[model samples]
Target: MKRFCKVRWIALLLLIVAGTAFLSFKNSDNRSFQLAKNIDIFSSIVKELDLLYVDTIDANKTIREGIDAMLYSLDPYTAYYPEDDQSELEQMLKNTYGGIGSIITWNTKLKRSMIGEPYEGMPAAKAGLKAGDILMAIDGQDLEGKNNQEISEMLRGQAGTSFKLTVQRPGVEKPLEFELVRRAIELPIIPYYTKLENNVGYINLSTFSGKPAREFKQAFLDLKKQGITSLVIDLRNNGGGLLDEAVDIANYFLPRGKTLVTTRGKIEQINMSYKTLREPIDLDIPLAVLVNSSTASASEILAGSLQDLDRAVIVGTRTYGKGLVQTTRSLPYGGQMKITTSKYYIPSGRCVQAIDYKHRNADGSVGRIPDSLTTVFHTAAGREVRDGGGVTPDIQVEQEKLPNILFYLVNDNLIFDYATQYCLKHETIADAQHFELTDADYADFKEMVRKADFKYDQQTEKILKSLKEMAEFEGYLKDASGEFEALEKKLQHNLDHDLDYFAKDIRNMISIEILKRYYYQKGSIIQQLKDDPDLKEALKVLGDTEKYHSLLSPKATADPAVAEK
Candidate 1:
């Protein structure tokens, strides 16, 4: 019976394929004939390779490789997803996944996996797991020698599954046992929202997913009740998600029936305009959106739409320009492909697609739209905007780069180690917003980092090395030897001096790391705003009613970049 069923299945597949070829042949169009011919050739080549190849071939893998190669000719966003990766993709966009709901990090020096952070109300947090807890083992397997990926795999499973964890929290006498039942954890699209001074509300929309507009509505309404007349929707580093969600979020500020975006494609059926479907939450609220280079796609749609409609003042750096739309099509055997199907245009009739991927240079390198090619578009209030790239900011705020010395300490886990030590000694710390590293605390931190065996090669040393190589190549090494030796001596970085020189920035970093130990992500969020220059500029703009209204009106003077990060 099994053999008969297999034969029947094969027969059905062959009949369907034959019918498709017959239809293509009957039509006799060049495209259909070419497609049919290529498919036949592909089938023949695969059959021959499987039967006559020198080495053993995995048929499924070979076919997948062919599919990937075929898709590689398209844009980067068009991708093939195998059967196994389907679930992961679904979980990422939908925000529903069965896992331990905690993030872990592997310390190469310590050789232990430690909890970096945990989602609130998740299995890991509910099981009494804290930020600094060390995972000794899972089930019967020891986790000490395992990397983050291996340990993470052990913690994930289908919902309703049980797992045993051995966690060693700092200051605890012994390892604590936890029996946790994994469940579907749904993370919020808007992770952080707070009220700032002068009655400004800050809402961070990390991604357009899982009813983000609804979430933003609630957050806005709640803040309105708290007397907030101004809002800052931070889309910095938001890579974006669903397009409809972007429309919905834009609708929160736009009036009903206002055209939000229009998508055009090869197919007339897909070419359509999306508009605000409901009454706006508050049209008169002073709105500013914070965007960075990573803010893209649907995030761009929301930001660009709002900007084109003159609903929100765009702040921060220019956004990530991605105006193309993608649609995922299911393939056979549970596989899928995400194909770029359309380009989205905002209210100003501008497609902010920066890269011209379809057109390549002589050397096959993709080209970006040149400055001369950028077209100008006008907003609803007649404010000048440009196309062929991202949404330009009305005001730009530059972020400070971490000094190399501070960067080295942070990257080498020295800061993490010191924060762990500080938490061990101190029972508690002040609120995140109020927390500040004192002079004596920095002194202690300097000492701790000194002993942490941190080292960094200076940029000047690299240039010196290059100079020495050039001198040697030119046979002038002996003449410059003495000068090179003196320069090397002069360039030798003194740890104590460097630490003192970059004290404020280093201290802020240490303060944040320390906050993470006590308050987790909640603390980090609050503490980040304490020194946020962008937030300061946003508040300044919103607080100054004259500047705010002028920015929205036609022929208004745009603020030059106050500071480049």
Candidate 2:
């Protein structure tokens, strides 16, 4: 029995030695061998410490943290998500979860989580949550110092559960609380759609969801029934969703059997082409696609496919360049890892991937794609198109930045607070499209601002005081220190004068907020459309059939400089 026990121990030792040898051999290969070697050594050390240490240690936690840190070294996207992170991952990919459906951003000036936007028909919107209302706490927990994700997680739960929100508006000294019920927040794929004119239809597709393709088909058919001959598909800040959905959407506009996109990868099966399978809903309809820098992945696929077929004229900014395809691998403990499995190529035979992370400069910056690396491709009308960074627009539209005064007004919650107070005082307002802040209402708002203490960060006052002290000590401003103090006081008085300069911008913001209170998301969008240059451009493109065709046709030889040269 003693001999058998000794032999068993020897066998176990031999197995351990063999395993270590095999791992070491594997680590001594490839460019990332050093990284693997460090991980191996760290693992070995951790095992040894856990087994032989005088105190107990959490092996799983240590390993998880180490893995997280290691992945963080690669890039922001490359992450280690454990079993606990699976739900969050699902929320991002599928874009559905139980929560109070509203988008919130931290107002740095106000130091509160202000509602930036709300999805139409969402629980938050339905519960009377408007943009700019500060979320002080959730279910009695103060949400200060939490990130967007953290706040989202806290707000989300099993459907039908209730959560209370403590909110503080601008003028309100006391915090108001509301009991909100958590529900399955499945944000719709198509938020709003309408006929732009007699023969033109516009559909705002927010995501490529499970039913987006079907929804789009119905929308197109409905428009066709309503005498639609042209369409504008807005894909700004869409951020993309499912690949199959994109293909389905592409098939709705392109001819049957036309190749939409293809994927190439190390894996043989992933290297397959995606073609339109069904008859097109509208092959002859004049389609205009609106894309911006935030439009990515599946959105790019739809736009690129349409561009390749000369089916649509893409307008607005260059698209967000993301050509890599990710596939989720189910791991142990219900966790999944979404690994980059393949590179997606659009119909023009070009990859719209922006970054070449493999090639980096000495300073760790990504090097530009050289001219030699660039290649040419053609669209259906023989239009030359190059790919690498992103899809360039047929016509570029420059974005306008908000003025500083307007920025402060929104950022500081002055407008938000005024809106809340106005909502409380007034029972109703004019329709979203017709609503305008009257002169009397503006006067009342200004008066309220005068009574309220809106403290902006006073860097100028601090600097001026410091400079005055320095000047007095240096004997240069011993005489003029008084003058500097007087000047500072005069500037303080003049600070109110800038209000007139910022009034129009401030009023616009106020108008948007107030409109949202009355008309909801659709109303705000309608109001913004009055000033939206992109919509106007899209309308013009759709209105002129000849000009639209010209824009879609081959203008010049593809510029290599734009792609890689």
Candidate 3:
């Protein structure tokens, strides 16, 4: 009787397993059928619209729009690229292109494209093109009424191809022309690295594209040769690129076989861990990483992994949380689709994807996961960290908001125009580090602002006006009329007073813009560093050995009192 019972139990278990498998197979088949039915319906709808619409339909554009809407409903990262847009994808991945190598901006007032800034050593700069030069024609083709994208396409072509470009200079009466050859322009991943005071080194990494690990290794070695004892890797405003490149960079500081990141998806095939494969270059060097809201994707991977391992002191504001991984699949007709395949977790086993794209609101809007909803995760040293948001800095430095006048100056292109005019008048100026706007320059700028009739809205005044309207609607305006009028008078915008009150900020903007025209991007960075609050805070943290070590320790992170101190 006992033997019979055992046999019966085994048979029942086998039957249950088979039943589960059958159910799984049936569900999979049902999903396939649903997908097929929806696709057929879509096709029929498109066919009917093409045949029955009153006006002739642009089938290609309409279908592409539909595809875009479908994809956008899923996530912002997933996108469709036709053959013509493949170059843009390639550029995003490789950061290289064959073109004249200059940023062109559309002048709304003039309704023409103009050279914004030319890369220092690229073809446009080499050919002596200046910023603010209005593009007139390209290869003998008139560019009048052509948008920036249309003109840009005309400027880019095969390497070694030559083309004629004509531009009208701001000060010059005649149109200038140049014959330029297109070359492969690869933007540098590590733009600038230098040894700082007290044996500290700084390396500014702009992107993770095109062998960033290799370039970064070389930069570190060079800095070591300069006898640096500490290092700062600035990832500020780096949107990130290839994931493997970020992994390789992490390997430079981590030990082999250490898990850097893990990706999980619907399919088991894509779920895997990325470990450090090579021996580290430096394990004991004091490291500080600078980050901001613009630091995202692979940038967050590098920063998050380091913070998780207690390998670096992250400074500045929180990072841009983007823990999603994407893979491109080739589609028909030379098109491609970049799809989000997986969500990644760092060494601490936390996903820092701020927004929950899966559960969108009724109006098709997405919101970030609130702090209260974030799950707490512990770092390697037992330090508490949280997920569902970007990586918070070990030492949070709040950025100061710029004044409204500065915003107006930038929006009106007054600062840019002033820089252009300044460049024309003064053929040479002080170097980037020492450049400063003189009192006479500020006076001239003020006069120009008055002459141009530059107008800007004061936010306070606008808010007061809104309050008045609301009060009138709610039948409270009469009672508060005197108060509103007094507030308006107090908040009235005085351009001359503002120019003098915010002179320092205006001068800084003018100086930086002018420096870029002379020294390009590197110079601007150097100049900005002279007064950077973040760098100052970083330097202070690095300078104090005990404080730096304590911030990364479990005791400091766990104990509220210690952390506050």
Task: Write down the TM-score of every candidate.
Answer: 0.87, 0.78, 0.96
lDDT of 3 at 538: 85
Candidate 3, residues 1-565, lDDT tens digits: the string is: 9999999999999999999999999999999999999999999999999999999899999999999999999998899999877777787778888898899987766889999989889999999999899999987889998999998988988889999999999999999999999998878688788998888999999998777999999999999999999999999999989999999998888889899899999899889899999999999998999999999999999999999999999999998889899989999999999999999999999999999999999998999899999999989999999998999999999898889879978877888889899999999888887888889999999999999898998888888889999999999999989998888888888999999998877888888888889999877788878888888888899999999999899873277887789
Off by over 4 Å in 3: 1-4, 556-565
Candidate with better TM-score, 2 vs 3? 3
- Which candidate number maximizes lDDT? 3
Candidate 1 global lDDT: 0.84
Per-residue lDDT of model 1, residues 1-565, tens digit only: 9999999999999999999999887777878879999999999999999999999899989998888777766677888888876655676468677887888876657778888778767888888787778889888787766788777777887889998999887778999999999998777577779888888999988877566877888888899899998999989888888888999888888899989889999999889899899988788888889888999999999989989988888888988789898888898888888888999999999999999888878886787788699999999989999998788888988868778887788767787777877888888888887888888878888888777666787788899999999999999999989999999999887888888888888888888788876676677777777878878888889999889888888984656664322
Q: Alpha carbon lDDT of residue 12, candidate 2?
A: 100
TM value for model 2: 0.78
* Position 332, candidate 1: lDDT: 83
TM-score, candidate number 1: 0.87
lDDT string, candidate 2, 3-107, tens digits: 999999999999999999988877666538777888799979998989998998898887788788766555445655687766667776766788888887777
Which regions of candidate 1 deviate over 4 angstroms? 1-28, 37-66, 69-73, 143-146, 168-174, 361-367, 471-485, 556-565
